[model samples]
Target: MTVRSLYLAPVTAVFPAPARTGQGGAAVYEQQRNRTSDADDSAARADRVVELLGARDEVELALKASLGGLPRERDETLARMAEVLQATAQGLALDAAAVWADMPERVLRNWLAKDPAFAAALRSAEALAGAHGLAAGPATTPTPAMVRVAVLALSRGATWPQAVAVAGFPVRGFRRLSQTHPVLAALVEAARRARPRKPKNFVPAGYRPRRPGQAPPGPRAFRLVRREDQVLP
Candidate 1:
């Protein structure tokens, strides 16, 4: 047989183009879809496995452990911190709690940073104390000394942190105090709003309104110059 006849002798020859709109075409499309879905599922499963094996939780737990002996449940410690913070909000001097529970300020700060619930309790206590005017000492009476100092500092153009320091209150504690002592806060705000007064002599000397003796401007005469009288090159 000739080369052309030999090449054509095979009955099962491959086609140059792909099949379309038939069972073979449908099968190819379904296979492609199945492969895409399988790839997505595998990627998701891999991510889940990585997350399960991650050490992020372990690292946080280790850090918390290094902060010394915080209460295991957090409730008791939170209660104690709340008591102190509540007093602060009621105008009890924040410095009065310097030796809170015989724990140093650094230790208390560490606890505040590590535990979210403890921080939240502190906020709640401050709010409650502000609303109720609960004092820090056993007397539970609000004091004017500390708030007055803070107001004075703020009125003198001190930053909030500086004012807080002058008043010997924690930053959040001072905010709570402001809530309880709205009058002091308002005074501080007013003082801050007090800008340098515009001088009585804003306008130059001899200007109208500022210089009442200055004569009103005279009306100008509108005499039109004739084209012949105009002096132009």
Candidate 2:
């Protein structure tokens, strides 16, 4: 086959252009092609977003499973403390978890300070949670300070890796934290919605880069400037 025939054969077989009744028919075909292309691009973007969300959910479930069980206690108050410890291990705040367990926040604090067995239980809970990638120590939630740092970095246009580095937190930990704290998730969404700023010296295509200390070229007003004897004033 000829070069022109070879080129047109595959394209015609794939697209199968409609019979040309007039210019309007061709215009309609073009519009349909453009619409189909746009729809496909939108679908691809949506799929990527869904995949990211699914990955985050998987990470959270894995972390929860790794946390194991809370220490058993005999007394009612100690049982309540165990409940609080479980809640906190799942990334809830200390006071919120205490309230969730139907215990007063002040009373929980008093128990931790005055009771030796309770303190020892607290230590055991911390070790268990920490072994499973949860935050340990006095703070209850999973790396609230690191989450704050990451949020701030993300707000300033940093990407996930950069934000995680700045926060000095693991990616899985950050994702897990976001699952518990709706406010942190909302802040991250807002940061994503914020438009990225372009560089100050951006230039369009067909333009040469300007030298340092030189001003930018102005807009073209005259089309005939390229023609012979058409001198720019």
Candidate 3:
């Protein structure tokens, strides 16, 4: 089974809420979670996703195993593998992010060696991911990788464009990188210390800094209710 087939189903699973009836005191039911894939099947799928994420490290060897015999005859596998990796990244949160976090340059290069689509996508993705990784930094003029990473961070509310302030870039490069790189940029953005922020309309005009052990506001919450008569017969 494809890695995409395994993890993506969960993301689409909406957070369930208590179902309410519209009229006539009808029974209400929450939307059901997909159970077609059993626990055993899910465990198996998770294992496969882990394997593929690791395979990215030895992409050449894995590609050789998947389509080595076909070589030029089989080009679709490259796209298939890339698609799986991308799906795992977007759908599965912890596992997918962890898998990619460990992905290094050496492993990616190894994978790119065997397949042409991977070779091309890797080159593009590398430029994007790498540039993004760099852009997550404090650099003003960064490599394409940084720009890609920045866009990804911006997409997720992690970082702001004004921080880097690159106004002009060519469309040929296809900064679609933002859609791809957020999972990593978030980490980089989080590491940066938050600048000392000024209080914004928070404290009142006469707001006074309370000293330790000082009196504080009280009665934030109160009850207004009455109990019905429960006299026993």
Best by TM-score: 2
Cα deviation of 3, candidate 2, in Å: 74
Off by over 4 Å in 2: 1-75, 91-93, 136-233
- What does the lDDT come to for candidate 3? 0.37
lDDT of 2 by residue, 68-179 (tens): 5422223335446777676555444455455345455687888777777767766776667667776533343446544544554564456877666545556777777667
Question: Worst 10-residue stretch by lDDT in candidate 1?
Answer: 1-10
Give per-residue CA lDDT, model 1, range 65-126, as digits (tens): 67665424443344447645654565444443322232345656677787777677667765
> What TM-score do all the candidates reach, one by one?
0.24, 0.28, 0.19
Clashes found in each candidate (C-alpha, N, C closer than 3 A): 0, 0, 9
Predicted structure with the largest lDDT when compared to the true one? 2
Quote the positional error of residue 153 for candidate 2 in Å. Answer: 27
Could you arrange the candidates by lDDT from highest to lowest? 2, 1, 3
Better of 2 and 3 by lDDT: 2
Ranking by TM-score: 2, 1, 3
